[model samples]
Target: MSKVTGDAFNFSLLKRVMAYVKPYRATFVWSVLLTLLLAAIAPVRPMLVGFTLDQHILKGNYTGLVNITILMLVLLVFQTAFQYAHTLLTNKLGQSAIKDLRINVFNHITKLRLKFFDKTPIGQLITRTVSDLETIADIFSEGLIAMIGDLLQVIVITSIMFYMDWKLTLAVLVPMPLLIIATRIFQKAIKVAFQEVRVEVANLNTFLQEHISGIAIIQYFAREEQEYKKFEKINVRYRDANIRSNWYYSIFFPVVELISAMSLGLLIWYGSKTILNNPTIEPGIITTFIMFINMLFRPIRELADKFNTLQMGMVGAERVFKVLDTQEQTEDIGTLAPQKLTGNISFKHVWFSYDQDQEAAPKYVLKDISFEVASGQTVALVGATGAGKSSTINILNRFYEIQKGSIAIDGVAIKDYQLAYLRKNIATVLQDVFLFSDTIFNNITLNNPEISFDEVVDAAKKVGAHGFIERLPGGYHYNVMERGATLSAGQAQLISFIRALVYKPAILVLDEATSSVDTETELIIQNAIDKLMEDRTSIVIAHRLSTIQKADLIIVLDKGEIKEKGTHQQLLKLDGYYKRLYDLQFSSVGIAK
Candidate 1:
């Protein structure tokens, strides 16, 4: 198993990985010294027995035998103590290394821009952080330590055997070449099996997470049977991979055992012939030779087990490294603040496409257009479905970068400002409201933990959520379930509005924040928005033209460009896209202006 082939056993990877252990070098050294001590004592028992058989038992000297027995017992006690200490220190070192790695991985992941999450699946990321890290811990605690011990034991035992009787050692080693060849073959199979098992496990995890999260969707669509079939397919693949691994592992042991048994038989057959032919060969010497035979083969069996674990760990390492190596969407290491100017945003000669492959003659989700939202004013973006309205808002957040032209926040290029600093200043109320499974008060005061309960009550009242929250069983302490699933859509939207308003950010972006509520609730929120946008930069994306009629400016988007732009009254007079949208809406409402 030590002969693992191909890229899995890359020496460069191991050398690169050694740097992670530098912090715990002192602990590592102690572990190595303990391992060497343990291996050195492997042949002591046989030596003690030989001493007893020669100088005491054979000559009927019970006193010498008794003294030697007591010494051997003391040595055993010391060996056990050292073994326990070795495990404790190694475990401490391994856990510390894992903690450091987890911290680095999480910090890097959170620093990544929003676009990274859009492209990567949540399940894959979770697997790297949890399962993959556990595998690495296993490598350190079990595989790595065992491999070190086995190597030392093999070398030390071979040296002692050669010193005791070189001819006997050579005879015992006759079957070793065949054993090594078999191990080499088994190692390749083991690596392939373990790699497959790791991948299948990842797939199973991904499938489970996705299905569980979307179970309601499946039930709503009455596709439960279809989802079950899909899940079964993934589960079957996982089972097949496990079975394949078991097949490889089952063959591994028997082949190794057969070779070991054959080698021992040969050793016994050869050593006994020598003893029979030469009366000068002491019974004690023969007994020691047989004991050494047992010691020599133990390390070989352990080496195979350690190598199998190392191969499994390498498979997990490959998956984990994939995450650590991912390039973040936006990485502005420069510490630059936004420049001063009017809060006017413009898309100059702006052309954008979400897909890069179709860049040439790309389906412009947003076309070459120019528009501006003035400082301290509400700008409403109105468009039909698939008219690039959401994409436009996404670009404003820099969730996706524009391929052509540029987006400026407060008349300064978005790229110039640090992403963390930019996001900190912009507050958003998304169409799909998301709430953590926490108290309503906690969700409202997400960033401002120091915010007084009075402040939370004020924000909630502003958004008209305080009335319902106060009526709940536990008022502010009512525990929301995952995503606040128990709350009605309108209630969730109200909570989201309160969350965004409590932050009191410089820039506010609300996408259909009032869509879920009735006309009465909408009017209440409209009053709240009127107060909230008094001196703040606000952009509202709404389908109901009535909800945004009071905007300082309104831009109508078609495909990916601005088709019309003006104040609500001015756009109604254009008799263009905005007029058509307004007429269609009012016509549905059976109202005429």
Candidate 2:
């Protein structure tokens, strides 16, 4: 968010932006040719006017005047045609390039590790993908190609001016230095303002996205007025940033107009004296010079604004490339893409930390944790909040890498197997279920071609969800809406269970999956889970001791380290951490332990 003071006409960033244009180079080349044609044809009009005035108009030659007029009309037609084609080509090329860039950004984001998402805001990423990249499209359509055309027009106009009469051209050029100084100062000030504007835009997007998504909480807490004031603060900053940038434009444009007027006055004063003193200098030359001044100053005036457009484009490019350049992706270098895996998992003296800075003294969330689950075995993780229960499941699924030791499935290192293959074989059912704004069937199969509709129905039936699902309006095709808002919490949990069931994963990880349901729903889920555990190696994280009483092994954790490990009866006999937890839970619920 720091103000960018560097040169806005950044070549390196420009080059990166052009790499996407390689596929559309043919259109780019055609656009450039048209631009050149328009520039070459521009000065011809004024020259023809001067020619007709001096050669035909002055002598009263009607036939010659008619011929010159016809030629001028033809030139105008060609210029218009070239302009139309140039605009079409540049716009076409701009859209095609940005489409590819947008896809690339989306692809990159999908592959990024969960750790990156844990730290970055979703809103900032949305701005980079949608709005910021949209600004870059202007670089091709309105900024780069258009600026080139304007610059060539200015150069050609200036050349023609000096060719006709060098002294008059020199007189007209006297005011340009002042304008140049003003332009430089304006560019510096505007770049800073534009950066501020961009920063505020991101902030506003983040605020709106967050508040809207959590509007229920805000309303429930009765914080609408407070939230509105916060939004007002951000909106005010956005307004001020835009106004500041506009203020720069307002001042700079008037100064340019004034400089243009001064050049016109200088031209008329000098030309009038010369025409009076010297009879050889024709009136037509003054008229042509006037047109040249207009031609020259118009582009010069527009060039500043277009330069601003180009700068805004570059600013967007800088932000986008920053996302593209991030290397925080989980390196899927393992070539082994195994088709099937046994339900055996092992963690050997594993150490992990979410803190990415290795140089600093690392704060590990899981310390020297070691465990094992054989094929068709059920292991439950029991702990209070922040005791690294979820961390265990996350690391087992390779969502985050461990700092020390190795994780393996069926004696093969987890990293040695392909990332997609490993993840597909391990299904996770989180406590808070997340369903897409899609049909029930799509959410169940997740669009997996291998899983047929029959398979979805069978999976749902096994989880006791088919009866309720068929009772709904659309049955399996019913729209769950966003995050399953159309369904009850227990219904959503059942759907998630069905989702995991169809995957037929070798390893199943449930993070407090049954802790949020009513007694009847829990009984239904527990029965389904019992059937599921007969084949798959299940890892369950739960605070409820009763739900995991039948697990083959319960590993109790406190402050990240293993405090106790045994079966329910064996741990009770030990009179240790597990028995204390069991007592505490039963006491809270008025059950005599």
Candidate 3:
């Protein structure tokens, strides 16, 4: 998780966030104008009441009182209109700015390299894009613009009060310094509290998303109680964080209210004495001052609350900017535009390590690896669990950069080709197949409108998936729920094969693609694989010895280095690592007949 600074306010972050609002500058300017209009109008009603009380009521003039009442009514109508416009414009500006920010975050996320996702949790990114952005929107709708309006109201109300009677204004303002100090304390304390709240929110989301996605594993191992306990601990931390934020609110608001009451008390005590001593001091003036004091202190109180919103939004902006500022993005500097690739792949002295940041020593997962496969040939990689077989495929796809040496295709470096074009030419089918919550046809084509329905159907039929797919209720249109939970493991793998075939890739890769299917289904998949392998470069990673027995070449890897490479019969004759691995499988399973 990215850490945010403890500073209560960040002007740099504010400036960056304000840039998003630049597109809606006209609406924001109009909102500010409406806020000024509202502040100016707010003090009029109290002044009218004081004038009517002193001039009309005291003199018992009915016509004069009625005229004053009509004027107050007009001010009320204008105030209401301005208030409505301000609310609407501020909300529109907030929402519009958030929309642009969300799109940019998503686009940046897609451009990031695989290593970033490997370390960062999916839920944390979701929170940044969704929940955190919404909080930022609150800064515009309820925080920044709203705070400015409150400040304007306070300033306007205070100006009017001092103009009316400077002595009473001083009396009303005596308690204000204490209010300001208390508010400053609250701001600092609540900023820290909200940062904790955001951290816990991201943690809770990460834990919940992880467990929810792996619910099957928990249930399979009967670890429900253990997992529940873990979740309970995270939930408690989230609750405690929120409670601390509430504690600040609980203490701060009442303190503000107490100071407001004290100011009112002082006004009444002093105003009564002044009126008693001087007969010229109108009673209506005291009444007007009381209204003015409420208007002034009310905005001050609301401003404290809006300050909290602003702090939380700044924290969100900081986290969001951290992602946007990441330097680990995949650099797509390749300019090659080859109309056709010959499908020849070569690796020379390749070395890689997933733990690139290790200070002591980075452990290489693949070391001094070298191999080559001609166009239209089949090569199989056989290795134990930590033997770097998958790392080879990952590097070939340029998902991760190699620490040393180079991987090339058709005598040109892999990085020389555009990233999108390189991946498009190399189709991959992993052991674990993933399908989105959409129709089967869309899942196969990945909603690519360019691939017609006939093309999808032809791909499925070629891979022997047409029989099972046609049996589905909606056939190709059948909706596979989340992760294709509705389909069997064999069925999902078949969809993956169809997806790869639809693209007609120049190179096809099967990373234990048939390991999860039953024998009957494996036979169907094997026949399809045989057909797909014809006239195309293919790479197979398999634990099952029978699957790669007929490969043109088999490479055996041990601890990140190639131990042996040859045809299966030749490797058997040498009695090397590949032969031993083949023996371990065949001797135990009676040759997988």
Candidate 4:
């Protein structure tokens, strides 16, 4: 917690960090004041000891010696107290500022568009938010202010040594150049080492996060040994970077100690000779010079390390600010917040591309796709993989913007509605149902206070999930564990259906929602969908053609374009893409139109 101010720092980044520090400026100011007090008091002790040895001890004035001893003890107590306050206040200031920063980082991350996440590694973001911020915390606790205090202490001690005996002080400082050279080399090496360590740590975090999440796939494919080898490589790189940083520390500290010992030896050797030749040079001054040299060298010994801490904080600040400055969040400029909508939907010649940033001709995923679904009808989308079936759903909910055309609901453009409002009204259940690690009830309600427990029960019963849920030990309160690990695939899918039902969305979307369920569970889900879509406009995507045979309309997509649209019987009669897809899906069961 020594003064940590002497190193090169990015003032621009420091200014940004100062914004968070503004709230705690008073505490910060107090901590600075304590650092100054500690620095001023640190040099006073040796001078007092020198004074006691000269006037009191040499004169054999026993009472004055006792008084001076008590006075020095009081000064020691004050220095210790000031140091305690300085440590407490600086650490408090750091944690308080970092807490606000962590909040802002999390908020920005949550608001960023999903597209940003697609390109970014989750582990890198994690490092920026958690590990980097912790390092930045050290900038305050062990860095800038403490560095300043050390610099001031060095100056004060050096000044006093010169005032007492300039020649001895000059002789002792002949070794300063060596320490400086060593410190500069150590600083440069350690800074690069720290950067490497940070990079390697981020890589390790990314590797671990992805591997752990996909551990099932790895094990199922029998690639554990290969994965372990890959992990070992990453782990070794991280270890090497840390070892390099530690090596610099190992070299630097011992060099400081050796140079300091040389300086002290020079001090004693010169001072003893000077006093032996000249009676005017006090023996007591030698003792004070010894104390001064040690005190002065202490901060010098540690200043380079503190400067590196500040530099790392700036580096960390740069990364965190970059995320905060990202402007790719989903646009929510629309002010309309309707309580409900009729869910009459229309897509007029819509086009979209996943790679919107490409300068080359954009590869459109959905090409001039147009469709309509009345307020109370179900429109099933039939297509092969990458045929733009789900792209329609993405555009409808505004997960991605279309390059052309418009999507409207109840004759109002979807973009005219507030983004959150539009999304809340359109509930989509994907093939991969994600449930949080929480009680089943919380997962269903998503911890919304407005949705009562009775509503959840009703939804679960409608989906035919209540029987199985109640049979569990804690029933609705059963802990699902992470990503619903404690629940079967069918059970998780059923819970998602119940969740969708309780929300009571105006427009329901089922994108292969029953793909994970067994035959019996799929049938139960089909019945649940029948009831759920009774009065709601619905869009369905399924590979199983039988599931959507009774839909009001079935739209077939091929290679990013709509090929046909009609009822099941009508599409079969057309003898086109829908007819072929339907035949292919049902041919395995010995049934085809």
TM-score leader: 3
Each prediction's Cα lDDT score? 0.78, 0.88, 0.90, 0.88
Specify the highest-lDDT model's number. 3
TM-score for model 2? 0.95
In the range 312-362, model 1's lDDT, one tens digit per residue, is 666666666666777764657536565533356666777777765553665
The stretch of ten residues in a row with the least summed lDDT in candidate 1 is: 1-10
For candidate 3, the C-alpha RMSD (Å) to the true structure equals 2.0
Model 3: per-residue Cα lDDT over 1-593, one tens digit each: 33444443677888899999999989999988988888778888888888888999998999999999888888888888888999999999999999999999999999888999999999999889988998899899899989998998888888888898999999989999999999888888888899899999999889988999999999999999999999999999999999999999999989988998999999999999999999898888888888887888888988988988988898899889898998887678998858888799999999999887757687999999999999988899988999999999999998889989999999989888999999999999999999999999999888888899999989888888899999999999999999999999999999999999988889999999999999888989998888989889999999866668868889999999999999988998898787788887777877742
In model 4, state the lDDT of residue 98.
Answer: 95
TM-scores of the candidates are: 0.93, 0.95, 0.96, 0.95
Runs with alpha carbons beyond 4 Å of true place in candidate 3:
1-8, 358-360
How many clashing residue pairs appear in each of the predictions shown?
3, 0, 0, 14
Total clashes, candidate 1? Answer: 3
Per-residue error (Å), model 1, residue 518: 3.7
Residue by residue across 418-468, what tens digits does model 4's lDDT show?
A: 998898899889899999999999999999899999999989999999999
- Sorted on lDDT, best first, the list reads 3, 2, 4, 1
Model 4 misplacement above 4 A: 1-8, 590-593
What's the true lDDT of residue 190 in model 3? 86
Q: Which structure is stronger by lDDT: 3 or 4?
A: 3
